[model samples]
Target chain A: MKIAEIVKTLDGSVILGKENLEKDVEMGFASDLMSDVLTLQTSNILLITGLSNVQTIRTAEMADITCIVMVRNKKVTSEIIDLANENNIVIIECCYSMFKTCGLLFQAGLKPVY
Target chain B: MHFQYSIEGGDFSRAGNASSQLKKLLKQLNVDSQLIKRIVVALYEGEVNIVAHAHRGTIDVDIEPDKVFIRLSDEGPGIPDIKQAMKEGYSTASQKVREMGFGAGMGLPNMLKNADKLNIESEPGKGTIVELTTLLR
Candidate 1:
């Protein structure tokens, strides 16, 4: 599904990479652990995480994850947004919890990374 | 070609800078995408290790036609038990580092999984050195 669609479905707001909302996301992985994200080998995965830190962006960049959805309306710092912009990673913020966000995305036809 | 980057221990902000630069370099060199992914993962993990554990470290990257070789040497409290350190869930990172979503003890195992050749050497009071090699396919 496209990021735009996911945002609309989850009532999310784009905090960065606004131009990338139309980008296609093939899979979704939700985790707060950067280590687990690094272990993933998939490309174009949408990282649904509650961790709002620079390391989230760094992990996304290393894993080639193009999109991130910050759940529970986590406070994303300016530095994190700036890094996301620089890396061309789309950031979406939503009030839904991680579980709810994943469910909404899954219901919308996004497959799991497994 | 060769490149070098220095890492400051406990500096979480700049942890992945070297790996990001190396990824761009490999892309510019037209290396295979799969090989590039492996190299980036391995090197990024090594870089994070230095940041989380060592006092300071250097990342030396040597790119050849067939393989990308990386040497990460750090000055800090070295790993006394390489065997224990190699375990998947073993980490010595402080509580602060753990809060940043790292120090889960998966760094070395992740490196081993991604690199074609991996070697680690360390002395308890001194430091640690990790060598990683990924062949371009």
Candidate 2:
């Protein structure tokens, strides 16, 4: 799925990397734990997480994850946005819970990394 | 090429800086994407381990034609039981660290899984040293 389609499905707003809306995402992984994210072997995955921190962006960058959807209306600071932009990672903000966000994306044909 | 990064313990904000820099360096060096990913994951975990447990540390990286080697040595409360610490679900991270989406006992194991070779040595009250190597092929 493309990042733009994920935004439409989840009613999310692009907080950064708008130019990357057409980027292809092969899978999705939802986790608040950066450790678990590191364990994933897949690339080009969309990270659906509620944890808003610099490590979240850092983890995505190291894992080659290009997009992130922050669920539960989590507050995203400018610092986080700056880091995401520096790494060319798309950040999306959505008001749905993590479970709902994952469900919506999965329903739209995005498979899990498991 | 050789690179060194200093890590201040308890500085969660700057945890993965070294890993990020190393990733960029490896990319510029034209290392294979898969090898770069593994190196990044292992190195990032090592960085986090220091930030979560040690007082401070330094990461020494050596990038060569055939492989990349990383050594992370920290001055902090070292792991007493290497065997237990190497367990897939064993971690000694503080509650605060765990709340920040880490400390799920997967860091070291993840590093081991990604690195072609991993060596860990520690002294109970002194510190710990983790050495990781990955082949570029």
TM-score for every candidate vs. truth?
0.98, 0.98
Task: Assess candidate 1 and give its TM-score to the true structure.
Answer: 0.98
CAPRI accuracy category, model 2: high
Candidate 2 lDDT: 0.93
Give the per-residue lDDT of model 2 (tens digit) for A53-83: 9999999999999999999999899999989
Model 2 chain A poorest 10 in a row by lDDT: A17-26
Enumerate residue pairs that collide in model 2: none
How far out, in Å, is residue A8 in model 2?
0.7
Docking class of 1: high
Residues B19-111, candidate 2, lDDT per residue (tens digit)? 999999889888888888999999998999999999999999998898899999999999999989989888778898988889989988999
Off by over 4 Å in 2: none
Reference contacts preserved by each model: 0.75, 0.90
Candidates in order have lDDT scores of 0.92, 0.93
lDDT of 1 by residue, B1-137 (tens): 99999999999999899999999888888887777888998898898889999999999999988888999999999999999999999888898888889899999999999998999999988999999998887
